[model samples]
Target: MEAFWAAAVGIVWGLPLVILLAGAGVWFMLLSRAAPLRHAGHALAILSGRYERRDAPGEISHFRALSAALSGTIGMGNIAGVAIAIAMGGSGAVFWMWVAGALGMATKFFTCTLSCLYRKPDSQGVMQGGPMYYIEVGLGPRFRPLAMLFAACAMVGCLGVFQSNQLAGLMQAQWSVPAPLTGLLAMTAVGYVVLGGSVRVGRFAGLVVPLMCLLYLGGGLLVIADHAERVPAVLRAIVLGAFDVDAGIGGAAGLTVKEILVTGVRRAVFSNEAGLGTEALAHGAAQTDEPVREGLVAMLGPFIDTHLVCTMTALVILTSGVSPQAAGVVTTAQAFEASLPGLGAGLVSAIFAAFALTTMITYAYYSVKCAKYLFGERRGGAFVWIYLVLIPIAALWTPTTTVNIIDTAYALMVIPNMTATLLLAPRVLVAMRDYFARQEG
Candidate 1:
């Protein structure tokens, strides 16, 4: 069952990169007039609270929403995903990851803007928005089923499977802990915050995201400083390897430029989850009337997730002279251990555990939001409980089986969600333009 689910999830999640993101990214890039690239400084300024207004709507602040989403994305992906990318895709993968991150900004803008536009107050009068809401509201009654499908997939596939898998992997690698035990401990921590609802989750993310990022970045920088002399050569190797005609990526069903570009971008999207409409679920809860405000905050997720944290992992792996030939989470573990020696592995393990647990908890809130949108707020508690209980079981399982299942489910959720976003994107774009024009006035 796990294997079956994993394949389905992988295909569902994986197919979008080739079809949805590839098409939507190219199209949105032109539509936004390349705002993500050209006016990136403005995006940064907006995130810095320079444009914040006191009269915002919603539940929490835009900063908190962004932090919640960032906390989820900037986890194992920044560490392990980068490791896997370098291993499978080579040093060139990092370059492509940047490309994906850049394109993903546009994706975030369109999807998250729509999230705010289609948002509605919940039974408790809390602002609710995400793929589920947009799917139901934007697509109308005829499309309600798709919305439910997405909600279920997100709750089980993302919140339950992927989160636990990553968290368990970190724990197992770090202390040689048993999967079920670590999963139970991790789930217990998550349940404490998630059962308290979005406010608690948001607050938790707001605090943890910044602190963890600083610690990880500081540690990574220390290692990089020690290997400063090898920096230039490492970069050269990346560039050269990317274009290597004789690097065995060409001849027999091997990687071409397009393949490399696509795979890297896809992985980056999965890692940061910027454009996939997942993070927007968390960010849509921001207390802001202006969609662009949240969108601006939302843009920071990819930058922090992919550019800063992912870069740290990449550099550590490259500088440590670690072989990227391993599978699972070990690739990253090896890199960190090699660089820092005795303390490196333990430190990386702890960081990964922190990141994974935080990510899972934040994601649980997201999935709960989706569940509430599809069912009722009352049903949410039941779904959340079931998800929490399943974590330990998932952790004890094979990593391949678990990740594949979660990945496949992730893919399944994205398809309907992506289609909904593409259909309603014009609405978002119009809202953005109108909001910006009024602000300028």
Candidate 2:
């Protein structure tokens, strides 16, 4: 099974897909005139409620929507995923992750904008939006097939299997709990929150995501500060490793350029989900009339997830001088333990639980959205039960198998999503022009 997954992920995440993901991001960045970079301040303003509308067409506030999206993207991917990249691809992989995050900012802007622009009313008359809605409504019924394809893949892709599996592993490692027991506990916790649907998901996310990020970031900072003297050397190793030609190079524990780039981009996508169209489902529910405002707000996700959180995780691991080959969460725990001794590991375990739980809830919302798109509103509730059931099953799978399954599904979802986003680029560009012009005027 492991070998099969390795082969599947290898084929799915090959060079063409890498080029497509990265190239499309660069294209979107250029096409938007670097809107993500130039108008980042505007994005922050919108997130802070500057352009809020009490009667917008959507369900949740921009902050809540972003919180929901962040809850999904900013979890295990920032912690365990980064550790995996560093372990497999070496320290240089961190550099490429930064690159992916930079490009992902623009990618999210275009995709999330389109999600809002093309939202539709579900059978229940509730506003619904996502890659499926945008692909169908924005591109017309001619592309309904592609919309279905995306929705189908998303049902499987957004299951939080990776998060569940890893969280179970964390429990087993940290507290010596049996995986089955941990899985049951996790499922009950997740099922309780998610049964209430998106409104509850958004509210829960809005409350917990920021607090979790702060707690994790605060802990990470202490680790970095304790090893302040090694910071510059770690940074140097990352940069040098990213471009190092030798296959057995000295830095980051020996990773070539190709390995670095591949691992970095893969983990970055897993972390921020820039092109996978998962987050757009969350952002599509934002209570706003301005698609551009939501898009701008959405762009901050990659920055916060990868740039802030993942970077901290990388630094802690690198500075702690932990083995590059160490297990994902264990290496991170070691770094924290090195810094604060007894308290550090416990804090990380708590943060891990929070991160994993929030991710599961938000991902349930994404799966519910996909299920509704695929099988109508009434059938959507059925998917929640299915999702809860899968949590324990996912806990039984090996980490590598779980990662491979999710990565393959993510790669599949990205194809239709990126195709639709590229085709609809001109519309987003026009919207951006008009929106910015109005703001300037």
Candidate 3:
């Protein structure tokens, strides 16, 4: 039964990511007249809120929504995901990650803008939006089933297995705490917030995200500062490896140039989730009438996740003189350990705990939005219960099991959302063009 479910998830989660992210990124960059790239300065300026004030529409501010979504993406991926990519793929993976981040900017802008425009109050009368919203409203009633499928998968993916894996991994590496214990504690803490609903989740994220980001970044900076001499060589290796045609790390089977490019891109997509449409739910709740302003703010997510936070993790791991190939988590821990000695692993463990908890609270908000939309309030609690219970089950599992389950769930959610995004691409373009035209005038 486990294997059956695993395979089902793999098929659903795996295929959509390729077509949706890689394909759509390529498509939007072309169609937007290279807007994400050409108007990079504009995107950054808008992110700074130079054009719009904080007194915009929905519920929370743009800063809060980005923080909430960043809390989700910036968690394990910046740590473990980078570890795996560097270990299996090579340092070259970091370069491809940067490429993915650059292209992801436009993707995020389109999906987030559509999220607000199509949003409506759910059966429970809460403001709701996401891939599901676009799938149902933009694609119309003909696609409602697909929308439900996407929502269900996201609840399981983000709130359950993903957070479980993150907490479990961090605990095992940091304090040698058993995964089951960590998972149980994680489950308990998450249950408290999820029951409180979206407003509570938003409030929680607004507080947790900033503190966690600073703590993690500060630790990473300490490590990087100690390894200052190796910085130039590490940067050079990353750039050279990005284009090297030969398999340098693992010989013929290790990591080829092609594999590095593809996997890095894949991991980057996983890390920031810009085009996936999940973060749209959090941003959609923003109290803003100007959809484009929200979109502009949303563009900043990848920069924070991939550009800032992920960069720190990548550099620390690369420059620590540890081999990610031999020991994934331990290698990363050692990098920190080299700088802080005994406290390195423990520090990272705490960061992971914070990251996992924040991710759970934020994603729960995303899932509840979809739940209220699909089943209304009556069945919503049932869905939450199922997710809350799965947290410990996920943590208790091995890393491989946890990651596979997460991958499967991710694919399932992305398929419907990506398809809807494609179908609604014209609307996004029209909105962007119309809004920008006015801004320019």
* Highest TM-score against the true fold, candidate: 2
At residue 203, candidate 2 shows an lDDT of 88
What number of backbone clashes does candidate 3 have, counting pairs of residues 3 or more apart or in separate chains?
Answer: 9
Candidate 1 per-residue lDDT, tens place, 275-308, comes to 5668778877777777776776777777788788
Q: Rank the candidate models, highest lDDT first.
A: 2, 3, 1
Candidate 3, residue 353: the lDDT equals: 82
Better of 1 and 3 by lDDT: 3
Alpha-carbon TM-score of each model against the true structure: 0.87, 0.89, 0.86
Kindly state the number of residue pairs that clash in model 1: 8
lDDT of 2 by residue, 265-351 (tens): 878866787888988999999888989888999999999999999998988887776543444333677778877888888888888
lDDT of each: 0.73, 0.84, 0.74
Point out the worst 10-residue segment of candidate 2 by lDDT.
245-254
Worst 10 residues of 1 by lDDT: 245-254
Q: List the residue pairs that clash in candidate 2.
A: none
The TM-score of candidate 1 is: 0.87
Q: What lDDT score goes with residue 20 in model 2?
A: 79
lDDT at position 217, candidate 3: 87
In lDDT terms, which candidate is top?
2
Which 10 successive residues of model 3 have the least lDDT summed?
245-254
